[model samples]
Target chain A: MLKNYFKLAIKVLGRRKFFTFVSLFGISFTLMILMLITAFLQTELGSDAPMTEKDNLVYLPAISIKRAVKDTVVERDTSYQEGIMIVDSTVTYPERINSHSRSNPSYYFVNKYGRDVVPAKNYSIYNNSSYDFFLNSKKLTFRALLTDERFWEIYDFSFVEGQAYRKTQVDNGEAIVVLTQKACRQYFGQESGVIGKEVVFEGQTYTVSGVIKDPKSFHVYVNAEAYIPYTNLPPAVLGGTGLMDGFEVVYQAHTPADIPKIKKELEHRANLFEEFRDDYATYNRLEMMSYTFRERYADNLYDEDDDPAQNLKTVQWLLIFLLSLFVILPVLNLVNLNISRIMERSSEIGVRKAFGAHSSNILFQFVFENVILTFIGGLIGFILAIGMIKLINESHVLYETTLGFNFKIFFYSFLICLFFGVLSGLLPAYKMSKVHIVNALKQNQR
Target chain B: MISLQNINKVYRTKTIETLALNEINLEVSEGEFLSIMGPSGCGKSTLLNIIGLIDEPSSGNITIANQTVNGYNSKDMAHFRNEKLGFIFQSFHLINDLSVIDNVELPLLYRKSVSASERRRLAEEALLKVGLKNRMSHFPAQLSGGQKQRVAIARAIVGKPNIILADEPTGNLDSAMGNEIMNILLQLNQEEKTTIVMVTHDESMARKTNRLVRLFDGAQVS
Candidate 1:
């Protein structure tokens, strides 16, 4: 019975060339867009590579301090009528500074403090510009992170050779550096085991201590060209070491199940620290490293309760709602086309009814037929989606972020096609099923 | 094989009520071949639909094969139609996508007692009986009008229904093709004793049946 229905459905769909083409075009295009976005999402947010232990790591990417309001007058040089003049402006703002703190501070690893370790992003400045050095006569300049041995406890870095700067080296302010695989090649004539080799930076020489694979561009939050101890960077260049801006504390939980307890403990630490701090300092935060990508990239500008985790959930639901809207429009188009199709098949349907096809049978047959159509369309969409993903990747829109097809995508596309098929076929099939058989047959005679 | 008492079919709208089949009381004995003749809009087809259980009579009591079908639900009626009755139409009503054998196999699909193999075997037998066994693989579009009607007839009897309801089975065919269809119908009635209720406008064809019921303006004339 189902075989006959399929035979008839395929024939009928082929007979109406324009209708079939229009329906397929709509369905395939909609699915293709959805697949492309899904692939990109999987690549961006999927827990892969360096983010593998994302579940067990909590990151304090930013700290907001609600300090006493301070009014300060700052002089700015402004040009008026082709002449430079000094102007004084009064600025009132909270001392909620992360990258810069007025009070003295110390590194978490050095102080043996804060219940966790921290890796600080350090930008070497020379004459108001990022510092660079000549290596093999080519200028090499890359962002760097300054940290101690405990930094390795919270991170999972795969080293090709040597190791991170040791605690002794960090404390001794030794001139040692860890370079990424790409950096090692750049500074050491493409050599892999160039550990202990010296690289020049800003007229100063630092020995390479380790080499690791360069993180992909998507791992921008923690990615850097080199790593060194904060103590190596003269104190003034670090914008005041420890508990300062550009430094985010990463708490390595024993297991993901202990995260809630860790968060509570973090809050307790913040409160305890606040008791001894200048009457204005305030603090609260511990976001999962995986969920904090957006906030981290945005320089952790999110306010309390606007944590990236909550923001991510809202964004996910919004994307789903938007994608569903895309699905609904094409569904309505297919339904309208199916309804029009009924005009030609009414007699066949009426005959089937007269021969004992119940309304339910009619409904099921129609929906099944439509599902077959959508399934075919989905295949086309899968191909088109691959093409689109390749195009986006080549365009470098997301910096070599790939959107390749995989088993999960295949499953998703299948369901999307089936959903569109049934959603579109329901109303039209129901309407035709309810038509009086006599009337339907009567129309067929005409 | 079939009994319809006080059958009435009416079409109602906001402004008008049209009688399609009124006080239609008839009985078709087992193995009987009966034809109902009428002019256009005489409600012969409507009465056929009501008897076939495709349309509900406004008021009527129907019994077929000793089963009280007056209050049968839509599901039951559909099952009854599939098991106990078959239908043929003026346009032949062949599903154009399918081959002749597949068209014949339609009724057997609803019968749980028949396996797929049995359905195929029975469909082949019906096609052979209709003298179109060689054309079993040909779609309806490739067949002649006469061949299409033969396929329809094969479909009607493939389920081995005791009663068959046909409406202008050869109406679209020429006189020669029409004669061919009549001969096949006559052969079924004679050899299998299959009861038949047919609606037509041709008096000559009506005379050939065991009995004729004539209708005018939704009412029986004789």
Candidate 2:
């Protein structure tokens, strides 16, 4: 019975060549668009990375007075346009004074009689232009704690020749620079071979100890041209200049299961610091590197102020919506064609009924017919999707991005096609199955 | 054998109620050749449809082969139709995309009582009986009207159905072709002893059957 239904279905489809082509084309186009969108989303979201252990790495920024302040008021003296003035106002005093001070000022500056008072004397207020000059002159530095050697354990990076910065390198205060392959090829020409050479950074020449692999996380600072020893950084950076110095400490949890425990311990340790001893600095604010790509990268995309991750999220949603619209429109077209085809076969259905075919047999036959057509369409759509991806890749709209047809996207497209085929064919099949044999026969007579 | 008791089929719309078959009671014995003759809208085809188990009577009991089939669901009806009955339509109803032999083998495909090879052999034999063995590979569109009707007859008898229900099987053919198809039906009835029930408007076609039943305005004429 099933074989007969299939044969009849094929015959019906063959008879209406134009209509069959239209339905197949509609299904193929929809599936192709859907596949392309899925591929684009997968590439943009960095879901293609092989790093399964990134969830445990937490990016810990050093708690300082800078990040805690609500408003940083720098009182400018109108007396002498560019000259300095010592503002005695409480609002601007802390900011102006803290801006010039390092993490541990006692180590660098001695108390010269009354000139350099321990805490109060270190505070200096300058006029607008002088303050600007002072702020500009002060070098910005970053500090991080490499608590575990496992910090480099979770990511995949290929070393051109040497290895990553070892625990011994950090313990010995050896200032070694780890150059990413891109950075190496950029600074020293492709054939320059700078693996064991000396490189200059921040007025200091550091020996090229090892060339570590480039980090694959999209949010990782790819421009870290040189990585010096954590211990070799000046005391000023280690302690943080003022409260706003760009000092961060990163810790790698042994496993993802230990992230909560590590976060809690780190927060407890941060609360013990003198600056955050009071309720001023909130302690438990650990940011994960994985989440930065998801949440923080949006603000960094176009403008430094806007989060790039949010933009990516919005774009993802827009692409999804567009894909859905594309799929739905074509499916609607197919559905319309299917209904018309069913109408044309009404007499055939009546004859089949007059021959004692059951309703389910009719329904199954029509659905199977539609699925066969859709399966063929799906193959064509997959080919089209690959072509589209190749075109997009060649266009380079996604600069520095790689997009291709992956298995997940293919599976998704196949499922979408099957769903579309059934949804589009069901109503028409039902209607055709219910065709009245008497009316059909009488109509044929006329 | 088939029997219909007080069969009434009414087609109802929101604003109108059209009666297609009213209180219809019919019976056809084994090896009987019956014809229901009527003009258009006279319920001849409707009565054939009800007897064929393609349409249900609004109020009546239909018994076939001593089994009550009035309330048979779709599956039961399909089983009965595939196993015990075959249909031939006025338009020949051969699938245009299928060749003559494939069309003949359709009923056997549904019945599944025979292997594919056996079905093909039986279909070829049936087509030869209808004098279309030479046109086995020709599609319905390539065949003449009489040839198409003959292929439809081959399909109707290929399953060895006890009853063949033909709805104006020769309506679209010329008188000569109509007589040819009627002769084939007569041969099947006389030789194979197949019960035949047919609906036709032609008086001469009605006379070829053993019994002629007349219908008018969805009712049987006394």
Candidate 3:
């Protein structure tokens, strides 16, 4: 029975070429857009590449310092006392002055307060910046991260050539660098054979010790084209007293279960360091917080004035609204088209009913037909989405980022198509199935 | 093989009630070929719909093949219709998307006991009986009015039902094609002893049947 229905459905789709085209256009286009968005979200936010093992890591990305100062204000009362050349009374009150500063945590702040406080298996402190290098009298800028040898252990960089610098090399402040594939091509005009080659940046020459794959563009914390040792940074950059900010920290716990303990310890350290004195000045209050990958991204969405939890909720609601709209609008369009299309076959429905088809059978047939349509449309959308992803990668719209299609994305797209099919097909199928036989038969005469 | 007791079908709207079939009481014997003659909107099709179990009478008790079917649920009615009755419509009512053979196989598709191969064999046999075996793959649009009605007859007999109900089977055909369809009905009645109840307006067609009943304004006259 199902086989017959499937055969009939294919024939019907072919019979009405214009209607089929219109329906397929709406379905395929909607699914393609959704697939593209899903691919982007997966690449940017999903567990892939260097951050694959990020579940057990906590990051301290910023430092917030607040202070309140007391100033004396004097109020005098004079009039009749002035006539006698004497003051009657003088009052002094303390005025409150509040100031707050927030930025990426400095190396000095992380080393002095954050290092011993968090109970973790390992940790790394890194500073992110960009530097200009002269190549044949042409200046090119590349993003760079300066860190210790422990950074390599914490990060899972895929090296294509050679290997990362050793602990001894970092400690001795050796002028060595690790270049990403993109950076290697830019500096040496070749992907391989770049290891052990020297590149000059701002009058300083460094040999490339390794060539690694470029990190995704959205990984702002670790997406550097060039990686060098922190010990090699200039004295001025390393001389920060907490006010100067360029560094961040990542702590790797023995297991993800130890995250709460680490957060608690960091909270205690923040409380203990409430009043901090540095070369810049003294702060009356300080807040040092740790975040998981999701929380870190959410934290970046708002400023210090906005509540992070509330911001996350708002963002979540917005995303749900957008996705629902994306699905609902196309579903509604398909439903309308299907109703009109099915209504044109009322005579067929009447004939089927008269020939022993139950209402449920009719319903099943229509829904099955719709599911088939959606699957076809989904296939077209999948091919189109892959082509779009390739185009985006080739065009470098995301700048060194390459989005990919994976099994997870494919599974999700399949569900979306199924959901779309059922949602759009149900109402029209039910309406047509319940049509009175006499009325349906009469439709042919009109 | 078919019986109806005081069947009443009333169509109601907000401010009007129209009687489509009024107190219709009739019985058809085994292998009896009966024809109903009526004017337009005179309840011929309405009565046929009720008898075929496609429309429910407002107040009636229906019996077919010695079993009371008025109280049967939708599924039971459908199963009973598939097992005991076949239908042919004036417009042929064939699904235009399907081939002629597929249309003939429509009734058997609802029968769970019929395998796909058996259905194809039965459909081919029915088409052979109708003398349209060569046009099995052609769609309804490719066939003439007479050929379309012949395909409808093939579909009606594909399930080998005990009774066949046809509404204006040759209403759209010419005198020659009409005679051809009437001859097919006659042949089926004589050879297979299949009970047939057909609704028509032609006196010549009615005269050829074993029994004739006339209707005027929702009531049977003779």
Global lDDT for candidate 1?
Answer: 0.75
Q: Which ranges in model 2 have alpha carbons more than 4 Å from their true place?
A: A1-22, A33-50, A60-151, A167-194, A197-217, A221-239, A247-250, A263-330, A389-396, A439-446, B14-19
Lowest-lDDT window of 10 residues in candidate 3 chain A?
A302-311
The CAPRI class of candidate 1 is medium
Q: For model 3, how does the per-residue alpha-carbon lDDT over B1-222 read when each residue is reduced to its tens digit?
A: 899999899989999999988888999999999999989999999899888998899998999999999889988988888999999888888888889999999999999899999999999999998999999999989999999999999999999999999999889999999999999999999899999999999999999999999988899999
Cα lDDT tens digits for candidate 2, A1-446: 55655666677777788987887788788887777777865664453443343444443322223332345666554444357655444344242212211231121111111122112111111000000111135533321222223334444455667666767876686767666665566556562367679765556566776675544333332224445555565666444423333333333455556655654554444333454335334432211222233333442343222233466577556656877788888878877888887776666667666565677767887888888888888888888888988988778776435576887778878888898888889988887777666665554332
Error of 3 at B28 (Å): 1.2
Give interface RMSD, per candidate. 1.6, 2.9, 1.8
- Residue A399's lDDT in candidate 3: 79
Pick by lDDT: 2 or 3, better one: 3
CAPRI quality of model 3:
acceptable
DockQ of 1: 0.57
For model 1 the local lDDT of residue A70 reads 50
What does the lDDT read for residue B168 in candidate 2?
91
TM-score of 2: 0.74
